[model samples]
Target: MGVTGIGGFFFRAKDPKALAAWYAEHLGVGAGPYGHWDTQAGPSVFSPFAADTDYFAADRQWMLNLRAEGLDDLCAALRAAGIEVITQADWDMPGVGRFARIHDPEGNAIELWEPAG
Candidate 1:
């Protein structure tokens, strides 16, 4: 059979422990060795952007997009926690989803998506 889904996402972090903690605390992402998350079944996107795409920061090589539910509530929580969350009206697609952008402590771009119901 072909590959089922993404197995893992490994990246280098300037401060792995701190970064992991941040993800776990704010986004509820699992952290530390043996950490794992059981995500809700849904659509996943695997597309490559053009070399000169302006959708995200040019300095970054890759941006992480995560599927989410309750977009408004999550955005509000993130804001309450003192994290800067970016939202643009134009980024929403009527049938696709709503989008928000946030960066890790290390400046990694993360796109949070809540698909339209």
Candidate 2:
């Protein structure tokens, strides 16, 4: 049988509990013991960038992109919480979607994507 979907994404964290808490609080991820999150059924992107690509931070090896809805409200909430959210006009595509960037407490680059409705 072919693979259905991503099973998990594991990574090293300096403070596992704190990091987990941060994800759950800010992005509503990694909530339970198994870090399982129920996501809406939709398209998921799977692509790798070149080593020298500046699409994300060069210092980091990977960036996390999350699918979202009601991005305007979410961006406002994050801003009100004092988190820096980055958006640029060029990053948006006509048929693809809108994009925003933010870093976690440990400076991991995260992309929030709101697909066209």
TM-score of each: 0.95, 0.96
What is candidate 2's CA lDDT for residue 80?
93
Candidate 1 per-residue lDDT over residues 1-117, each given as its tens digit: 998888778899999888889998988887545557777888889999999999989998899998998989999999999889999999999999999999999999999999999
Cα lDDT of model 2 by residue, 32-60, tens digit? 77898888888888998899999998899
- TM for candidate 1 is 0.95
Please give the RMSD of candidate 2 to the true structure: 0.9
Off by over 4 Å in 2: none
TM-score of 2: 0.96
Error at 94, model 1, angstroms: 1.3
lDDT score, candidate 2, position 90: 98
Instruction: List pairs with backbone clashes in candidate 2.
Output: none
lDDT of 2: 0.91
Give the clashing pairs for model 1.
none
Q: What are the C-alpha RMSDs, in order, of all predicted structures?
A: 1.2, 0.9
- Model 1: ten consecutive residues of lowest lDDT: 30-39
- Tell me how many clashing residue pairs each candidate has: 0, 0
